[model samples]
Target: MADGGKVVCVTGASGYIASWIVKLLLQRGYTVRATVRDPLDAKKTEHLLALEGAKERLKLFKADLMDEGSFEQAIQGCEAVFHTASPVTFTVTDYQVELIDPAVKGTLNVLGTCTKVSSVKRVVMTSSMAAVLFPVTPLGPDYLVDESCFSDPNVCSDKKLWYVVSKTLAEDEAWRFAKENGIDLVVINPGLVLGPLLQPSLNFSVSLIADLIKDKNDTVNKNSRLVDVRDVALAHIKAYETPSANGRYIIEGPIVTINDIEKIVHEFFPELNLVDKNEASEIIPVIYKLSVEKAKSLGIEFTPTEATLRDTILSLKEKCLV
Candidate 1:
């Protein structure tokens, strides 16, 4: 009943970013069909219902990432779909089985469904900055992977690297399917997504901050580029409107460090300990930084790194998480 098929479906609606996406869409008077693996699970849906006057405008559907036809049902009559439902596990033994199949296959399934659903005009997928911002060259401390870079799965197949492999392959599958099916798809690849978490269920992407806040490491260097979740959400909506934004859009800070994030958290929450003075295991996983030039050109604004970190601390405090 929405104008121009204005219904928007967001997969993984209970997630940190997807919840905010649903909130924003509902705030703008768009009917949002939010997908959860189990819609009846009151624990998950309760918080989402409480976000930004969402109780009435938001609808819930049971759409599992691995289950086919689930997305098809959720995406019915929707003009846009924000596919952000891939697993983000930290360790994996099989890239193809654990990471690749679900990430790639899940994306393919979504695209296939999008093709069947005639009303869907666009899809703003949540790809990671990991895919396009990784270095092809081997280890170099000076590596600040730009948008032109890509993670070479052949060169690196570590367990920790499997998540990157999944994202890269998943986005590739989406583009391939989009081109073949003639569906409009825009990918938003964010680097080390940070800022206030809207949901309790955060993927490993944002879990790094939580890990660091618990002082999981002492010498871990915080040098990966970061992006605010609110900005990333805005980027999704901006890409939906911008005519020239049908390609990959990487969102990130120029130079961000979790150490800097810790400093900010310490500013407001003085009792928090995001760092420890010990020689324990502390190696920051290397990930590609983002290039927000494309997004900026489209009028997307990014929050300052310090402000984002400060807000992150505040949000965690609000949730009583830290």
Candidate 2:
């Protein structure tokens, strides 16, 4: 589909990844209808207003993920819809209240609006790799994971992996809704999303990195599969623009351990406290490798893992968040 002059709706427009999606869309000359939890929250939305062409092309709407029909007005008459709104917390007192309900209900709400708006040809969903792979177990050597894998729902509990369960269920609901209602759908499953954030505040995932820099997380056994926020954003645009794009796409970098991150940090910014040094030196085995072959088929060349880490650290430096 042609991007120029088309109207698109981005739910959770003020979020880390969504904000970058909005910026890229506006840069390409598309009219953006952006949804925020509170439209009047200047601190949350001021950066969006300052974007290029936002004065003429950006429209802000107040919407809530838990409330049905809240996104109807913003989604009407749009050519494409990006469903990026969902809870991202790893710690929660109530899984039902804090994570699961919002993710599942919010996904259904957005898809319901898409069904009503006949003009919407495609709905690009921002699903997490947590849906495809979480509560990650040790696998046989060289065992690789692709889009076909789904995080086992049985393992989820209020005390552990609630976020994983929420995303897994929400994405399943999206696919079911699309199949039953005949809505064109595309899903993006990204791992450990990181990069320079357009929004003023730090991202939840990015905050974990900040925490790591400050010697926060003591767990040293696991490794994270990282992806640049800009690459993720571009993948969203490609998913919408490419008519042949369908099903799920995994976006990620090489998985690295906490000690690896420590080495990178010390290599880049020795001025900061050495956090990873105190952790275990044994590198986590490559239990499961994520394949990005489908994303590559769509002409998405991911940024190098070293560059991704470097840029993320540099951005954190610029924000004084490190």
Candidate 3:
């Protein structure tokens, strides 16, 4: 185990990425205060409690993102806060009510609590590539998307890409709040996070993969910048631990298409039937690159796309999801 006496609070402890963050933090011997929607939810809390060292080092507290001051009890006395809790759904009847308010307001609520606690030295936030890349603009092949890029909320709203809008707005608010309050903030913007699932439920990204496997003709033509869940979890910790780390870091592996995923699935499990690349609909591949140099500087070497895909499929199989 790594040397860890520091106390840290992780919001949204029951989430796909947050669960891994909690697991990793416990492995390092940190006393973790994890916030979930309901501590009594067995499906969400059981796997967390089962983690190695969790019995001694992990504590779960109930916290609702939209509920003001709900995070205070969990965040008090923590040296650092890892704010990973946010809505991840794409299909919502009310985008503002279901996604935007929770993401933006919930973030401020967490930061507000942090301001009251003097022990908090830094806050590591989980933002998404959706904040960096959307509104569907055409870019040159040489144009590398970096942390500097911000998705246009106007465009996202007009396009009904409310999830992108929420992430973009929430991250924007976080930076503004951090600046005004003199808070040490580090944000990790991960691409489509795919790897082994720690939570019992299927997240949007993993569900996309599972849907493709279960359906012979369900292949998307868009390109996706992928990253392993474990790497994303480590990046959060790295951003928190590295003294010189600042601002935003884009965490991703490689840019791949749906066909690439299908090929990998076929390679690993030949018995499993998948959509043939030739039969899959093809659209003009988006030509752009994601810059991960800043994240790499934090000493995070990402997992290979093949290995991530393999692990993702294996995890789904283990859960009987695929």
Candidate 4:
């Protein structure tokens, strides 16, 4: 797909997963119009600029999520748009301003440009698993979630699931806009994405792992799924390139408990000081499973859980992040 003239645009190019997408796109020889909040901020974009083929193939554009026409120039001639930008943070003061506005309004702003730009053929949206399930509650063992399910926004709001609410509303808006305007849209719903980050600082997902290792809290009782950041980026490309790809694809690895992660850490780094292994903690039973058959049908082989977790820790250590 990357034949030099095949241009694609990635919003929030300096982010954790988006950076990998930009890197992969540039390495494949595609002309990439990468949007950042500030293109001139060397500290944020230096790593991106240093990537292979970045000098010639990558063009940085200054774009903000809230601004109405901020992403238009970047999306002008692109064949595909990878909308990976969203305000993601666990700590929230104002849900409306911090999470909702940037997610819903920013998504509309981006898709609104697609209506004007005739060259855009497809859009691969970066939606989260949070859109599929409520944040605080675990799915029952009998409950299984696929593309068909959506998190109850009412539940999210009532429970103060701010981040989940943002993602759910944003993705809902994207689907509605695409259907109404005849724009082809594909959504990638990923679990907690973690792995080697091209960007310098640790992302929210990776930070959670760091906190877990520090044993700051007894979160071992909670069970959740994870996907490698690179795998998630690849899923975005696959969703865009595959002709038959339609609807939402859940890109997740295996469901694991926090104790499972601790076991893997012990196997990989035995010398490091870890939470007391002898501490008996109740194993959190898996409530439900996220279906990945749809993603696998598109020929995406997910990285193994152990390898994914190992790479995440090693990368954090290399960056002196953990």
Indicate the residue-level lDDT of 150 in model 2. Answer: 75
The 10 consecutive residues of candidate 3 with the worst lDDT sum are 275-284
Could you give candidate 1's per-residue lDDT for residues 47-143 as a string of tens digits? 8888775766678889877888878778998888898888877566776788888899888888889999988888999998668644467645566
Q: Model 3 off-target regions past 4 Å?
A: 1-4, 135-138, 216-219, 277-283
- Name the 10 consecutive residues with the lowest summed lDDT in model 2: 275-284
Instruction: Please write out the lDDT profile of model 3 over residues 50-139, one tens digit for every residue.
Output: 999899989999999999999999999999999999999888999999999999999999999999999999999999988887745646
lDDT of 2 by residue, 76-187 (tens): 9999999999989877899889999999999999999899999999999999988876544534557678888777677654437789889989998999999999999999
TM-score of 3: 0.95
lDDT of 4 by residue, 43-82 (tens): 7899899999898889999999999999999999999999
| lDDT ranking, best first | 3, 4, 2, 1
Each candidate: RMSD to true structure?
A: 3.5, 2.1, 1.8, 2.0
By TM-score, rank the candidates, best first.
3, 4, 2, 1
Model 1 regions lying over 4 Å from their true place: 1-5, 93-95, 138-148, 158-160, 201-206, 218-220, 272-290
lDDT: which candidate is best? 3
List TM-score per model, in order. Answer: 0.87, 0.94, 0.95, 0.95
Instruction: Report how far residue 171 has shifted in candidate 2, in Å.
Output: 0.8
TM-score (C-alpha) between model 2 and the true structure: 0.94
State each model's CA lDDT, in order.
0.75, 0.86, 0.89, 0.87
lDDT of prediction 3:
0.89
Cα displacement (angstroms), candidate 4, residue 49, comes to: 0.8
> RMSD (Cα, Å) of candidate 1?
3.5
